[model samples]
Target chain A: MKLKIWLSLATISVFFVGNTAFANEAEETVTPDEELYDTSILIEETELALTEEQMERALLLDEFANDRLSEIEATIEEGNIEEAEQLIEQYEEYLERLESELEESEEEQEASEEETNEEDNEVERVELPDSDDNDENEQGEDSDEENQEESAEDQDKSEEELRESAKQRTIILQALLEREDLPEQAKAGIAKALENQKRAEENYLRAKTEKAVSDEDEDEQEQEKEEEETELQEEREEEAAEQVEEENDNEAVVKAEQKQNKAEKKQQKAEEKAEKKQQKAAEKAEKAERKAEEKIEKAEEKANKAKEKAQEKQKKAEEKAQEEQEKAEEKNEKKQAKKAQENRQKEEKKNGKPNHQ
Target chain B: MKRAMMITCLFLLCACGQGEDATNDDNNSGQTEAVLYENDVFQIEEIDGWSVDQEATAEQEQNVIFSNGTTRLIVSIVSKEQTIDTLKKDVQSSFSKKVELIEDDENYIALLTNRKENIRGDVYFHQGSEHQLIFTFMTPEQHYQESKNQINAFNEGITIF
Candidate 1:
């Protein structure tokens, strides 16, 4: 048994020691100056090829650009100006790729928006004559509008994030340029990169301004079109009213008076129907409120009943415990009395025996 | 019985200690090998001390890198269109002017030395029917000879289809 316990402890200690060593090995990292650094670059290139999305690719390119910047700084610190220059060139290439990718993504988003607008226009053209179908169409339009709003918000958020990243890059580059120990060759590269970053930022602002202008123009055009449509509708209504007046002029006075009275009766009937509908809706609301109140009351009553049952159970348990305690006390008292009686008998026997002696 | 138990405990502890020492020796000498990467083209194993550079492998499926301390072994599988002459040109263009073609035949091996970086590389190219495999083992110039056995062990684990 002791041997088994010792073996188990030895095994456990060995296991823990092995695991700690493995963990330490796993936690080790390779830095840029190491021989495996080129491997790291190869892996990064492979990942870049596999990434499919434009915005994600652009973000990744930005990350790689930052990595190159750090590598350049490290190389410069080690007095390896040639490698720093090479890293700077690579950084420039990454920046160029990132700019192109951002542009492509923005253009794609705009194209998709245009396509959605065209689709909405087509849907609007296919209007149904039935009023119920028109209501459904209106709801569909509302959902489409909501989707457009969400997409617009997403686009704004992405653009803002990109701008923020660009700003950050600029700040880093500016700081690097200001460093007193920076080599002349590296300083030139950083200055050029900083300029490129500023240009990219300006391009983003330009695109945003252009989009805003275009949206304003579209809104203005839509408003003008709506005003024109309303004007035409008013003109058509005026024409119909003139025709009705001419018909009245041609018809007898009594007939026209009868037509007017029939129209007034129809309006009154429509008003009565509307009032009844409102009253029915109000009654339904009241019924719902009463039903909710009854449900709450029922739930409360059930809770009270459960509480009462639990209290009664607790009381019964308490009474049973008290009875058990009292029984134990009575038993203890009887045992003590029996012991005292036996002692008294012994004492009497002793006295009688001594007297006989 | 108590003395026997104490003796058994000491024996167990000594055995465990020896086992640990053996494992450490194996890790240092690159004696143990395990399959580190595999695909349709080929399968390769890494030496005991070496670890796969996961960040690199995660990015590209065509290539994998194993590193042991400052030593690195990079394995890449490319198209068979890469000829020995093209491989030579690639080596010449990438490496320093001091790089030498030490071996030439069915397998082209180049020794690359970069004085500035104080690193040396032994690059090997193997062409199979469907794919061409390139292995580049790099280490500090001072330790290049010491890493030869590890490199050889790593190469022996490669089985190409």
Candidate 2:
């Protein structure tokens, strides 16, 4: 029972793990917006291997060629031109054999690739989900009918994407191979790879151009995002400035209003004080006028009384002073006449400018 | 068998034709064991194909091998303050393949051999200035240790020009 339970647990665990693994695989296989390159092609079409005997022969031939070349070089150095030429011929012959063998190997690889491709196509047709299989078959049948229309649309899109990617890869490879530090042999290989890559890129571009134009949505989105961020930053800055302005405005308005209130109160107080001063001034003026009028009246009364008394006294004194006044007037007239004559004489004598005084 | 013998015979004949033929000529030729150049500032001569390039300073007498593809020059300079045994040991270690210490004492010194037999005469050490030269012949191993007086005399007689 324990064993059974353990087996059950193990099986359950495996099932869960397997499911998880399958989920991951499915996730990897099904990109939301991209087509996955199936590795099944490469797996089915394994690289062709050279036959052991052929490899050995090729190695031997290479060695032989190298030895012969060395011998030729030495012989030429030693002034054996004829011997060197013979060795050169042998080297060429061996090289030709090597070329043939290489060609054969390449052919074999092509054959293998074709066979694998066929097998892969067969498997692919059958390996899809039931719905996909039915759909694919239906698509195959309808491909004749609707392929032209569908392909025109699909091709344009695929081609553009493919071309863009190929261009990028070619540029990358070219950049890689162009490095100065790469070894001579590696540089040569890289050059060849670059050439092939360029060709592939060209083909991909050609195909892509034939298809629908690739959507610029991602690029647009990125640009939009950048623009949004910029706009948002600008908005934030505007908001910040507005907020600051508002705060300043609020502060200034409150302060201004408070100051205005203070000024109004001051003005009102000044007005009230002015009005009170005017009233007090009026009252003072009135009191002063009254006091003045009383004094004037009193003085006038006294004057009147005094005048009467003076008149009485003057009447008595005038009779006595009349003679003195006449005498004083005559004396004053004489003194004034003398003074005027003296002043005129002194001004005339002092200066012409003093004549005006 | 016959063909093998013929090839061997041909090889031997070629070798024999190339062997040194100066055994008696060296003795009769009024040749100094060591020839000096530049008024005796430098000296160089072959001993059993072992070439010596010798130079001298105020403090020591230096012997060198002018053999070896390498530009390296090995100098064995002797000073009055140093011992012959030490000098000999030094020379032996330095010129293990090309030179050997034949005789060494307070009053006399000699070096035997100067070149490696199997390494082809491609590599050697030699000493000379543009103005001076000194040459000393390499002594055979068998006679080097035996002829001490003769070796010393040879070394002592070594002069420039």
Candidate 3:
């Protein structure tokens, strides 16, 4: 009874002490991330955990194999070459099996991915989108001969209009996307179709701009010719006005002053023409600036898409490399374990305990 | 009260005497059987008056006698290296028992006490060296010299592979 009482007291004290020790240990080891990060970090952490466990297993196997190899070395030193050779053969066979298993799994993954790709491509496509619906509808029902002629004319008009619009849109969009003043967020929102449209707008705008510039130059040349013609006509009119003034001078001096006023009117007209031309040039520059801004935005969106794709590719490559490393480690571990077991047996035999079945 | 004390004293003496008698019987039987080392190193038989202290280091055993008829054979294998004198000193310090040094050569050799009460033999093989053997024996002082002939017979009897 006394001994049992003492034993119970001892057990209670031991339990109390153990609990206190465990609580103290737990208090001392508070990890920072556990307190800070969310559950996704934990999930990401779980991915690493699997590889770590595999690596740890591999390490154990490596140690075991190394120990076995050392024992084999010892045996060789003891002139037991036959036994050592047999151990080496066993180790090699185990490693080969491990390597083959790794290769087989990798092949299986590749085959499955190939099947998925094939299935995706095998999806049957149906009809394409309507490209000429508006034109077809406009050439309505009538006598077949009239309708066919009208239809052809409408088709030709629609084709020309589409071609012209496509070129104009590509130029405008490209110019807008290329503009430096555009914000980054604005650039990201442009879609692939919008990009294609912008390209067409930019081309059309460039052609239109070139045509307008050439037309303006032609108009300037025509104006110069008209100015020369008008100058000659003015000379004639001035001469006639002077002649009229001379004829009127016999009647009255006030009539002679009207001839001098005609020259001042011509000068006022020339100043007005110059002011109007300056205003037109300023407006054209503004429109070009807007187009340039849109083009800049489009280019930014394209760059962002490219960057995202490259990042995704890099992430996938990293995942593949990690998987390969894990597989290799697992193979190594299996090999190591086999070696360790053989080594352990050899050690036991040398120690004369012969721990075999 | 006096009678109770007397009875308790008598009971204690009887208990001790019976324990001694049982121990002696165990010792005699153990001496006749061969001593087997854990590593299958060596075995010796027919020693006289053997006793074993089982509470030793996990890897080793100490102080057991082998018997051949009336003679006692004591055997020990030491697997560490030190001078014979140093080993003798360490054993004496650790075990607190004097070892009679008989043939103290490069490897270990020590004989047992030859008196009738001290008829115990001892063998010390330096398991320190890769290959070294030592064997020692003791008998009733009358048979002390005669025990060498019996000890030599062990070499002839042992078959090493």
lDDT of each: 0.70, 0.44, 0.47
**iRMSD computed for candidate 3:** 29.9
Could you tell me which residue pairs clash in candidate 1?
A47-B59
How far off is residue A106 in model 2, in Å?
2.1
lDDT of 2 by residue, A129-219 (tens): 6564677765764654474456445434533543454455445445544444444554454445445434433333333332212123334
> Which structure among the candidates has the greatest lDDT?
1
- Tens-digit lDDT string for candidate 1 (A137-216): 88888998898898678667766766787777776776677665777888889888877776666566556655665665
Candidate 3 lDDT by residue in tens digits, A50-88: 221222222223222333343334444565555555544
Off by over 4 Å in 3: A1-252, A289-297, A300-304, A313-357, B1-161
User: Highest DockQ: which candidate?
Assistant: 1
As a whole number from 0 to 100, the lDDT of residue A87 in candidate 3 is 44
User: Model 3 compared with the native: what TM-score?
Assistant: 0.20
Which of the two candidates, 2 or 3, achieves a greater DockQ against the reference?
A: 2
Please give the ranking of all candidate structures by lDDT, highest first, separated by commas. 1, 3, 2
